[model samples]
Target: METIGWGILATGKIAHTFARDLALVPGARLAAVGSRRAESAQAFAQEYGAAAAHGSYEELVSDPAVDVVYIATPHALHLDNARLAFEAGKHVLCEKPLTLDVAAAEEMVRLAHRHDRFLMEAMWTACHPVIRALQKRIRSGEFGTPRHLHAELGFRVDAPPEGRMFNPELGASALLDMGIYPLIVAHLLLGPAERLTATGDLSERGIDLDIAITGRYPGGALATMTASMTSYSSRACEIATDRGRIRFDDFHHPDRAVFTPYRPGRGSWAVEPGEPVVVDGGEPVLGRGYGNEIAEVGRCLREGLRESPLVPHEQTLALLRQMDDLRAQVGVSFPV
Candidate 1:
């Protein structure tokens, strides 16, 4: 197909952002939008220039023009939303933390296979140019051995109790919202987590509000990560290696990563940072990188691929399993 048709499900904040970025991606167009409310769907469609709008998800998926469905619903609703799309013979690009837990995520993946439809977790960070470039360099041993990593993402969420950020039914957990970024970054730059220990503060309803995690990764690499909804964090990340250190601010949409080499200091065993080397994601970052993922989905559909190499099904499932264990450790659990 020369162009790919996208049907966006849900008209929430993230959906708006994705819709705006979708325009930046070539060979991609907003074919339609779906929301439980007709007004919301129509407004989203008009704002994003979608060709059509539907009051229900079923209608959106049934739109013959939509080749792929972009599920922007809450974490708790992803499985059902994806099931709707898959059963309707449409591919899916669901938002991250794919689901509330591993079991749900697994079922979603199975559904994709059963329907012979493409599915990808919208883990845009993996598709980011700078992060991808950094991963490539670290994998090549360009920065020597990455011995330790630190990442934190946080912002005081002032949403009401019934809002998505604070509502337990909506899968509101700081780890799922903010912490997953750190976890994914560590997994990318360091490796799969070998052992993890977690501690956190939770709300009366049992949702995590603040969390800190320490883990051991491949080749003995160590990582410290934090996610919080009740405080302000710098959202910075760093990887320390024998030869140098890589640092970036606002890892969520970082423009570049800087690597500073180590050199001998005053003492025989001491070392200090030298001049820094800046790394950029080779291609232009289209609208904070969401466009890259949109482009990836279009590329995959055109190439007849079921999963993305950058954000593979295995990786999505692996991280969900880790989060499940972490939530258990932190005494956070949602109602069934």
Candidate 2:
């Protein structure tokens, strides 16, 4: 297709953010929007300039104008939503974590292959310019051998018990919503986890509210990560290498990654740091970085690719598997 058409499958906050960034991407347009409520669909369509408002998901997926569907529904509904889109012959960009567990994610992938359509988990952090650049540099040994990484993302969630953040039925957990970032960053920078240990506090509803993860990655690199729903965090990330230290004040939507080299000392490595190098994301970070993912989706569709190289299916599944283990260790389980 010359121009990519997008169908947003929900009218939630994330959907709105995606819609806003969709406008910034070239060769992409919001063709339609769907919601359980007609009015919600209509409002989202109007706000985003979608050509059609679908009261039901079936209508949105079936709309000829919609070449691909962006599933922004809750974690629990992703399987069904993606199934609807794939069955209707539309490619999918489903939000992360792909599903509550690996089996469900595998099933989603299976459905996509069965339907012969494109499928990708919306792990936009993997597509962020800064993260991508950092990954390349780390792999290239630009900053020497990575030794340790620390990333934390959290916030004081004040939503009601029935809301998506606290609702077990919606597959709500701090691990899914917040911890995924730290895990993904560690995977991207330090390579896959060879060993992992987790500890956390769960809500009365059996959902994780606070979680801490420590892992040993490739090259013997170690990482410590945490996610919380009852406090505030800097949302920062730091990676220490033999040659230097890389830091991002806000790794989630970082503008740049700063690397500071260690200075030589009389008898030991300098306790003080040397000159710093600021690594730009290499591409313009569009609208909180969601635009980058949209652009990625468009590029993949235009190239007739089945999945994004940045957010590959295997990577998504691997992270979900890690989460399953972590949740099990922490005594957190969601109803099936």
Candidate 3:
């Protein structure tokens, strides 16, 4: 197909953002939107200028006009939603944390490979230009060997018990909702961890309210990450090397990063620290940066690629395993 047609599976906030950004892509068109309620579907389709409004996911996937489907449902529904799209012979772009557990994630990947369909986890941060540039620099060995990485993301959420944030039935937990960002940063910069230990505070509902994770990489690198829903944090990420350190203030949707050089020891003859060099990620395009990942999906479709190299299936599975391990350590469980 010359122009890829996109269908959104849900009418939630994240779905709306993806719909807006899909419009900004050059070779993508939002052809349809699906929701449980017909009225909700119609309203979303009208607002996004989509041609079709599907009252159910079945109708959306059966619509021949839609070449690909973007699953924007909650964490618990991702696996089944993706299965529906894959069974209907459409490519899928599922939201982050792919699934609640490694087994589910593996099943999704296996299904994709079995059907020869395109599938990717929508880890939008990995698609950002700033992250790409940082990876390039790290590979180039410009900052020496990375020794330690630290990242934190937290915000106060005062939602009701039934809300997605605090609802155990909806797969609510700080580690899955917010901690994934910091973990993604660590994995991107330091690869997979050889050892991991975690501790967290749990809510009355048996959900994690705050979590702290420490990992040791195979190359002797260390990473510390934290996420919380009970307090506020800087939401920053720092990667320290022998030569210098890179800092991203808003690591999830980073638009700027600062690199600072540091020297060890208090010797008078040691060279003084140099001024930090700033790198800007240009400007935000189409709804807080979802456009980049949308464009990536279009590119992969056009090239007949089934999986994105940036957010590969293996990486997605590995991250899911890490999260599963963390939850096991913290004694947090969600209704499967």
State each model's C-alpha RMSD to the native: 2.0, 1.8, 2.4
lDDT of each prediction vs. the true structure?
Answer: 0.93, 0.92, 0.89
Backbone clashes in model 2, listed as residue pairs? none
After superposing candidate 2, which stretches have Cα over 4 Å from the reference?
A: 266-274
Give lDDT: candidate 2, residue 93: 96
lDDT of 1 by residue, 1-336 (tens): 899999999999999999999999999999999999999999989988999999999999999999999999999999999999999999999998899999999999999999999999999999999999999998998889999999999999998898988889999999999999999999998889999899999998889999999999989999999999999999899999998789998798989998877666745334445447788878889897899999998888899999999999999999999999999999999985
User: By lDDT, is 2 or 3 better?
Assistant: 2
lDDT of 1: 0.93
TM-score of 3: 0.94
Candidates' TM-scores? 0.97, 0.97, 0.94
How well does model 2 score by local distance difference test? Answer: 0.92
When 1 and 2 are scored with lDDT, the better candidate is 1
Instruction: State the weakest 10-residue window (summed lDDT) of model 3.
Output: 266-275
Stretches off by above 4 angstroms in model 3 are 263-275, 281-287
